[model samples]
Target: MGIDGVVFGCLTPNNWLDEEALDRLIEAAEGLQITFHMAFDQIPTTQQFEAIDWLSEHGIHRILTHGGPRNTAINENLEQLRKLVNYANQRLTILPGGGVTVDNAEELAKQINVNEVHGTKIISLPEENND
Candidate 1:
């Protein structure tokens, strides 16, 4: 893999993250040649912005977020999350994951206005396993 960067997936605990954990994650990421893409749980818009700002201060350029749970798909929360990402587009690359699927990936890509969308299984299992 010619990937020059990496994404660090950390679950936001209880809708809130411990500063100690964040600090440690940042420290760990700094040792690598990859850009850290932090994946957070369902956090408020304000907090989400704060997280992005904090990561930026630490030199993290990519941010990935869990797009809510599966139930939220029908409630428009996913769309709302996308809006938040778009709002913060100037600061970093806001990539959404978790519930992303091929069916709604195009919609998410369009709504978020991001060229890339990340997912664990975006490619079929066989393709992923092949490498």
Candidate 2:
């Protein structure tokens, strides 16, 4: 079964994924993109930086995070997000998500100086019908 890649979420938190599981995933996803989603924020900041280096070393393609705490506006964590983005410069991709919306994605991305942006709010999804 050949799939484009895998998104780590809707399952367990990123920290919940032990090294064995991550290695297995990395091995199984060779030649494909393996994204570590927002759960990155669940880990302590100090550990998160170490994890960033480790993830990059292990070939994790990208990571989605809110930078500080979950549900906090991206603006509040701009400094932290910028640091993460800069640290991940060529090692891996850091995608700022969570409170990001289309209205602010541009400014955030610009300030963070990242080419890629994440979060569902960027796209306008149609409302559901009540019928």
Candidate 3:
């Protein structure tokens, strides 16, 4: 439909990547950019790096993640996020999301040395209209 890119994700009941399902999605994408979404965070920490390697090897362009458990502040997840960025080694982009906000996004990006991030609040709104 002329879209430039698509976010794709699938996980098994055990929180591992569902390669079969993902393959279908990738095949359907037909060369559009693929960003594996926050489902990356649902995988167990012990397996996350391996998942990164797998996704990179399989042609995923990036991953959107919170860097740690759901609902935790992004600051607390910085260490793990940094590790993920390092392990990726430019093989794929690590786009942090979850608790990121305009107020903290710049500092967080510098702290992790990543060029991109994700969040609804990436652009701030006035307090009265904020939602």
Candidate 3, residue 3: how far the Cα is off, in Å: 1.1
lDDT of 1 by residue, 3-112 (tens): 45555644455565455666777776665543444345455555776766766676666667655544555226566567657666667676676667766777777776
Looking at model 2, the pairs that clash are: none
**Which parts of model 2 are misplaced by more than 4 Å?**
9-17, 124-131
The 10-residue segment of model 3 with minimum total lDDT is: 122-131
The alpha-carbon lDDT assigned to residue 95 of candidate 1 equals 69
For candidate 2, report its TM-score. Answer: 0.83
Question: Global CA lDDT of candidate 2, please?
Answer: 0.82
Who wins the TM-score comparison?
3
Residue 64, model 3: lDDT of 99
- What is candidate 2's lDDT per residue for 1-131, written digit by digit as tens? 77887877322454444677778878888888889988788777878778888789988888998898876778999999998988887689998888889789999999999888887789777889999
Candidate with best lDDT: 3
What candidate 3 gets wrong by more than 4 Å, as runs, is: 125-131
The TM-score, computed over Cα atoms with residue i paired to residue i, of candidate 1 is 0.65
| lDDT of each residue in 72-128, candidate 3, tens digit only | 999999999999999999999999999889899999999999999898989976568
lDDT of 2 at 128: 96
